[model samples]
Target: MPAADLPLLIEAVRMAGHVATGFVGKSAKRWDKPDGAGPVTEADLAVNDLLHKVLRQARPDYGWLSEETEDSSIRLGHDRVFIVDPIDGTRSFTEGADTWAHAIAVAEFGQVTSAVVYLPMRDLLYTAARGKGAYLNGVPIQTSAVTDFADATILAAKPTMAAKMWRSGVCPVFKPAYRPSLAYRLGLVAQAQFDGMLTLRPSWEWDIAAGALIVAEAGGAISNQRGASLRFNSADPRLDGVVAGGGLIHAALLDALA
Candidate 1:
């Protein structure tokens, strides 16, 4: 069933990307959330609306959870729920940047079964299904094989590298990088473009659900900042944080944080 759902997710995410691209440089209306959640543009809502209709119509029984849609407890009663972020990097999209992405995933009883993360402007599509391998633009991808922390290139925010967060009171020697889209950062790790990625602040489920599967399917390990397994479709959808990389690097990062 997960395999079957993969195609549907891929198609839905691609269409969402298409819808989003139409407004990329066209000055789509922008506004901010009341509690400083972040800026949102009309493009984000348009894509969210399109994905909701297309995905829900195809699987009416499946529940839905999306950044643009209001939260509901009804999804908790379903075995499979759709988790989505119409535009992962709204700030980038509003600024006419190509790094924004559409992230969609199917979580069955708290575990991701199928997922797709698409960046239309960049023309990169990442996809995965439970047990099957991850792919980028239809070609298989794998995490970086580098095993030493000193040699790793990690995608993360500046705060993630703060010395206070590490047990040694010093950051690792890996090259630090930044990406506006959390989903895209995870995909980079899956594609071996970056050895790993993390954010110590709590992360929303919609932002990382799809990328989590992609990294795992690509022969990488992904978990919360505490090195605990990630489970989706929960009553509270926010994750403690995310840390993903090749097995050794992933373990190393967690140990450093500890």
Candidate 2:
């Protein structure tokens, strides 16, 4: 709500972004999540520590939730919470790729109000403020106007990690997308660089919070695969699905994936 805090949030993310990039291609140690789909690295912990300290200093009243930290009931007491993913694409980063970066968001009363996704490798920052509009770097951004589904360029969340869904009637083939970071992937749609993205793999609040606002403000739509609204800070943090598309091809994209 405070206009001055926007720049501070951006700065914190940018600084964190720099630290994350420092570990790239360094053979950082990685471990798998409980589900074992991908890995988490030490780089994630380093950035998570930096983010918590910086954000708390900037806004002590805000609560915290991040992929690297243990979930606590403390966040429910605060009016605002900072949701973060220290490294959204650890697999990519560990593989000597440039798709990883720090993702952060600020949600008030469970409603995402502002966000920042810093793509350190590309030096592209995607940000948003509810009602104010979305931006890439300092310039404003919007989703694509492509009204036709056939011509739209799509990004798949599990693009290369699709072997897990072969039995669900939905083929589990991860499509190769240029933006490896989930936050940045949604940003592409908001910037009109891509038409949409589909992912059967569940995503967390921090993964898409800023990107949701980015696409929404950029004249697009974001929702569960069944075309439902999103609610943050739930007991179960996993979102069953997500379809982020420019306003036009949204419905059709869902149908095609079905």
Candidate 3:
């Protein structure tokens, strides 16, 4: 069942990515969400519409949760839901950066079963299916084996450099790289291009669902910053930050945050 959904998920994300790529470097109408959330664009809606049409038509039984769509209580009844971020890095996309991506995932009984994150501008495709491992353009991937938290390279914002975010009052003690898309950053960890990734702010499920599974499939571990387990398709699809990395690195980071 997972294998069957994998191709469909990949195709839908690729299609969304293709649609989003058309808005890159071009003038796109944009606006801010109510209450100072973040920017939104016509591109986001366009991609969301396409994904909603293609993916849902392919599997009508799956519920939907998207960054650009209205949330509904009906989704709670489904055992499987499609968590999507039509264009994850809208800032990157609108600013003509190729780091943005379309993130898609199918969560079954609160766990991701199939996932895909495709950067249309960059032509990078990341995919994962439960028990099948993770892949980048068909090649299997894995996270770095770094055990010492200080030795691990992480993806995070400049503010996280401060030591206050950790329970120990000391940061991970490693320099972190910045990526515009959260999904892409997690994909990098899964590919071992980075040892780990984290965020100190709450995150939307669509932004991390696919990436979380990708990391898990690649022999990495992902959870809330406090190292709690993550479950999807809930009444509220928001997470209190995230911490993901190769096994030992994950453990060490979790301890620091704890």
**Which whole-number lDDT from 0 to 100 does residue 213 have in model 3?**
96
TM-score of each predicted structure versus truth: 0.98, 0.88, 0.97
Better of 1 and 3 by TM-score: 1
Clashing pairs in 3: none
Give candidate 1 regions above 4 Å deviation: none
Taking all chains together, the TM-score of candidate 2 against the true structure is 0.88
lDDT winner among the candidates?
Answer: 1
Model 1, position 173: C-alpha lDDT score: 93
Candidate 2 ranges beyond 4 A from true positions:
35-37, 157-178, 255-257
lDDT values for all models? 0.93, 0.78, 0.89
Question: Candidate 3 residues 1-258, lDDT tens each?
Answer: 788999999878777777777774448999999998789999999989999999889999999999999999999999899999988888887788889888999999999999999987777899999999999999999999987756778898887667787788777678689998999999999999999888978899999999999999999999998778988988999998988989888887778773
How many pairs of residues collide in each model? Answer: 0, 5, 0
Please report how far candidate 2 places residue 80 from its true position, in Å. Answer: 1.0
Clashing residue pairs in candidate 2, if any? 158-174, 159-174, 159-175, 160-174, 162-172
lDDT of 1 by residue, 27-101 (tens): 899999889999988888999999999999999999999999999999999999999999999998888889999
